[model samples]
Target: MRVPGSPRWAYGTFAWLVFFVVSHVVAVFFPGEDPTGDGPWDLRAYVIFNLVLILMSAVGAAVVVATVRPWGRRVPRWVLLTPLWLGSALLVVRGVPGMVENLLMATGIRRGGFVGAQDISTAELWAGLGINTYFFLGAVLLAMTTVSYVRRSRRDAHG
Candidate 1:
C-alpha cells in the first residue's frame, strides 16, 4: 500500500507559520496602541504575552516541519502527536466560540459586549481586525493540516 501525501497542506501550514512568526516579530518591534481604552498599556505585560505567542508559534512550526519532512518519520510518533493534538484542541476551543460570538455580534442578536470594541482610532481598529482575521484563518488552516497529517501518518503506518 502506498502512503498518501499532502504536499499542499504541508506548504500551506509552513506559509501560515511564517505569517505567524513575522507578525509576532513586527508586533514586538512596533507595539500598537492599546485597544482596551481603560488605562495606560503595560509594555512589560505586552512583551511577555508576545514572547509566549512567539514561542508557541515556533513550536507549532516545528510540529508542522516534523510532520511533513522525511527525517520526521524517524521521530517518536507521540512527540509529534502530542503538540498536534494540543494545538487542535486549543484552536477548536478558542476558534469555535470566537467565530460564534463574532457571528452573533455581527447579526446583532447578542450585543451587550464584544471583544476589541474599544478602539479609539482607525489604526487600532484595523490592527485588531487584522489580528483577528489572521488568528481565525490560522486556526482553521492548522486544524486542516493537523487532520491531513494524522491521516497520512496512519496510512504510512498501516500500509
Candidate 2:
C-alpha cells in the first residue's frame, strides 16, 4: 500500500517471479502433475511446447527485476517497461475472470466451468482458483516493481 514501488516489494516480486518460473520449468521437465487436473496435460506432448514459452516469460521477468535493481539503471527503461506492462496486463486480464469463475464454482455460487460439458470437480475447482489467484498476484508484483523502477529513475534524475 505504501506506494507499490519499494525496496522490499521489489525483492519480493523478484522472488515470486523466480519461484513461478522455476516451478513452471519443473512442470515442463516433469509434467506429472497437472494443476488443471486434466491428467493429459502432464504428458510429454503437452509439455514439450510449453518450455519455450516458459523460458521466454522467465527472461522477461528477469529483465523487469533487473531494471528495478541498482545494477540495471544503465539499461534502457523502455526495453524493460514495455514487456513488464504487457505481461502485467496479460496476467490481470487472464487472472481476474478465471479467478472469479473458479471462486464462484468453488463456492457453489455457480455451476460448471467454461470447459465444455465437463462437470467441475471440487479438487479441480480449488486448483483453478489457486492458479488464477497466483496469476493475479504476479500481475500485482510486476506492476509494483515497474512503478518502483520508474519512481526511482525519476527521483534520481530530478536530483
Candidate 3:
C-alpha cells in the first residue's frame, strides 16, 4: 500500500521533537533543582533520565520522518506504528498531570508542593511552568499528528 504523506504535520512534529531534544540536553547539563525539595537525585539517575528523554525525542523524530516519506511504505506497518503509538501514550501520560498541576497553581486554585517549600526560588517555579507548557503542547501536537497520519494511511491503503 502507498503511504499517504502529510508533510506539514511531519515537519511540525519534527520541530517539536527537536525542541524536546534540545530541552533534554539543557536539562542534563544545567541540572535544575528538584521542585519537591527532594535533595539532589544521584548523578547516575540524572544521566539516565535525561538520556531516556533524548532517546525518546529522537524516536519521535524518526517516526515523523517515516510516516511522511515514501520509503516508509516499504517498511512494515507495525514497525512504523508501534513507536508512534507508544510515544503518543507516553507523552500524554507525562503531560496531563503536569499541565493540570501547573494550571491549578497558576490560577491560584491550589498551592503546589513548591508552595511554602523552603529554598525554592522563583526561577524554579517559572521553569516548572514553562516545562509543563512545553510538554502539554508537544503532547497535543504529537497526538494530532499521529491520528492524522494513521487515518490518511488507512484511507490511502483502502482506496
Which number leads on TM-score? 3
Off by over 4 Å in 3: 1-6, 30-40, 113-121
Report the CA-based lDDT of candidate 1 relative to the real structure: 0.72
Candidate 3: tens digits of C-alpha lDDT, residues 1-159: 343345576778889999889977987787766622364767778778889989988977988888878887777777877888888888898788779868766775654533534354678667878888878887877777788788867876899
- When sorted by lDDT, best at the front, the candidate numbers are 3, 1, 2
lDDT of 3: 0.76
Candidate lDDT values, in order? 0.72, 0.71, 0.76
lDDT of 1 by residue, 33-142 (tens): 76224556577777788889889878888888888889999988779888877877787776666666556544555542155344236565445445555667767777
- Best-to-worst order by TM-score is 3, 2, 1
lDDT of 1 at 133: 59
RMSD (Cα, Å) for all candidates, in order, is 4.2, 3.4, 4.5
lDDT of 1 at 101: 58
* Model 3 poorest ten-residue lDDT run: 111-120
